[model samples]
Target: MPTLRRTLGLLAIPALALATALPATATAATAAHADTASSRTVLPDAAAAGWLARQLVDGDHFESVFNGTAYPDQGLTIDAVLAFAASRSSDEAAAKATAWLAKPEILSGYLGDGTTEAYAGATAKLLLAVEVRGANPASFGGVDLPSRLRSLQTTEGRFSDRSQWGDYSNAFGQSLALIALHRTPGDAPTAAVDFLANSQCADGGFPLSFGQPTCAGDPDATALAVQALAATGRTAKANTGLDWLAAHQNADGGFAAAGATTSNANTTGLATQALLSGGRFGTGLKGWSRLVKFQQGCSADPAVRGAVAYDATGFNAASGTRATAQAVLGLAGTPLSTLSAAGARPDSPTLACPAPATR
Candidate 1:
């Protein structure tokens, strides 16, 4: 029941945003108003979903199969799930790609190669995917997702992990952990919220690490945190961070990744959600339209019809997998939580939130 309720709640955010985003006028009026109107690009929802649909390998798996780079099927598959959900893709191809990710083998891979101990961040991501898709994370791939996500939170309020990635997944993991747990029945720990909120640098952007000494705001991390906070009803607290993001949009209709700050689709896609959350999509319309420009159309190749590019330079099979997945969500005007579904029975007598450490 908790999961079902969360699902219905999430399905409304983007619909509201998109309605607000459309121009009040018709074609000629919109054409004349382009100079000042705040609107979503002309990109069709089906085209974006179709591009992601083509990336699925075999009938069930998606891979960076084209980009020469081999990303773990686990991460790529999760992205596919979000892409389908945000676009509300109901075609046969969309169903197959989503179904493939539900397989036990694929879910286990998120924990890592089945032979090794699971990575907390990977597991959290899979749990999020399961929840968003209305799958039972407690029994997903033979493990309980909500329980494992809780165990990963440390006493200090960090979803700290020393997995092989060496804490690299900390910022992302913390944000995701909060979001995944938010879908269940309970207040996501106040400490966890503070942990993510305090991670913000003076610039109002969060770094990849919550406690880094010289951390700068990152488009990806900051944008992600924005979605988590917005979905969880902390939008006021997340405002400054959203403002920082709006301020940084490049003159081009896009945003840059951390460090490089060059306009790119991935960052733009992620940031677009934050902007929408802040009700500042008009301020960042250029950035949003910049992403529309990144989409590969049938003119290029009907086979890659809706593939989104990483940068204006053009699409690369390698980076496009993640970038396109992330981009589609932003383009669809949804957040990371839009994919969250019921992972466990929070109503169960035995289901309990982990107690936060006493300060």
Candidate 2:
């Protein structure tokens, strides 16, 4: 297992400022109004814990599916999958990630052609793979991943556009690149941190694009940026983003995706992880507890429980195991207490694989 290291920095800002500046109303009213506290309540204890454990075990299978199918596309979906894989410490996931590290097709598709989405996702995945798998960052065909990463830089310290791909002003894209740079050695991490810090909106949230009309500080983008910042040793910046997340939690306790009405397990899981990464455990616990409640038992609602069917949107909801893995990683931040009592270890499961490949 990779040792988690902490870095100290000097960018303190009161959490109150964050709460005041990024008020819940700043999020879309339509999105906020749609959520109801009644629909989002705590689940029975057995059901919640079981859901979390099952998800952790199933995370292994999700990585397998992603490596086999989604990874070939080299998109944001793959990036998210890799982040989840690393968090769960999937066994064979490292092998598939190593394959991606070695594959020029995957690298060039994103970095060489200026595919912003792919570049962001692939960069994040590669960084996490190195950290979790202990893979040699430089061993893959002498590929200078850092240099390829630097190629994405724009004059503003953010990535610029290539081949008429429009302005590269996406927070999601920048966050992934920042995460990659943070994991790589040298000044790239510093530059990435500077870029992200300067990009923070007055609301303490981050906009998806620079100077774009839709650039309201959003929860999804903010969460990604917060995690990237935390990974890079900028805890204060990460905390500011987390404060925004805390305020965005619906009355029911789940997070909405950039002020969207629909609160799915996937975005909630990401936001929860980001909050925990920033050391905002109190808020993380609340959000996570709510998500656990949603997964109480097999149900028709994808939010309440894992889905029986497979769709791109609900891919993460395929099984109770998938949701459980994500929630456990997000909330517990370590192996389940129950697992330890049963003589099972963190990042390792003794359960037989579930059938039908839920989701």
Candidate 3:
């Protein structure tokens, strides 16, 4: 028997295989299968965790959703690590992931990229991930991840990055920064709360960027802003944003991004967590229902079990890992700030696997 490190559950959807790993075109069976009413509804946590668990490459790491290979994809690995720990489905994988992250090579590239220099979003996310698993961000992997995050903060309390993807470095990264710094309140920027509150649009939602002459509400950014505001006991503000979100829920029980034409599991999952954080589950349940249907189950091909498509359009590897992983958070009803241990880590079931085919 394999020497078990700790309890672990992961899933690998065949629909999630890297684009290069498959033929030039998606097969009809894989592309045409959509979640219908008759589809068996599995626990969102179980379905997503099972899928996340199977994707572990070695005893310690998750395969990249982008390449379907076992490389040092620490940036993406953090999502699965936090998801498994939050769902109580895989402690071993979480622990092993923590161990793997302690290595220097995997983290070196994440230090920065593009014009913004430091990968500010990556650093903030890692801080949140380490904290989620009960690990110390201050000393994880030789460098203090939390300290690194704070160093990136501006005096204005805005955690902005002006890089190639700098446009994406606003509310999303700022939200994570606020949550991570909350773990160490003293060190967190005092102006952080106000920064987020100021980002809110007249519609009671927040935009993905700051300094916009006008407020344009983004579903994803609004959701995260709600959670971040709630952390500071700003229920009045949080509720305002939540109300905007409530009004925007698509009849299908899901939400789209600020300007997107279609609703997606990824946005729904994110909004779900934010609503739960603000104590607004009543408005979020329909979306939750829509969210769960995205996961593949026994009725689907065995290889695709536990997979979650981004939306009804069907599953695509491009969005599978991120969409499913985020869905698990909503399915479990645990927000990013509340993902500490509820069930013991040892209580999770195991998924059998072959030895790592490659490092």
Task: Report the candidate with higher TM-score, 2 versus 3.
Answer: 3
lDDT per residue (tens digit) for residues 1-359 in model 1: 23322332244235334445666664532332232112222233335665666666775566544457755476777777766666655345544655666676666656754333557678777777777777677877567778777776778777755466565557777788888888877646778887888788887888876666797888888888887777677776578888888888888758888878678888888787667645675754555567666766433444554677788677787788788788876666666665532232111011111244698
- TM accuracy, model 2: 0.62
Question: Which is superior by TM-score, 1 or 2?
Answer: 1
Winner by lDDT = 3
**CA-lDDT, candidates in order:** 0.65, 0.50, 0.69
Per-residue C-alpha lDDT of model 2 across residues 237-320, encoded as one tens digit per residue: 777888888888876667776657665555676677677556676777666555544433222343434221111133344454
Candidate 2 or 3, higher lDDT?
Answer: 3
lDDT for 164 in candidate 2 is 54
For model 3, the superposed segments whose C-alpha errors exceed 4 Å read 1-42, 62-72, 113-117, 162-168, 185-187, 341-359
Q: Residue 96 of model 3: what lDDT? A: 79
lDDT of 3 by residue, 40-70 (tens): 3333465577677676677667555345544
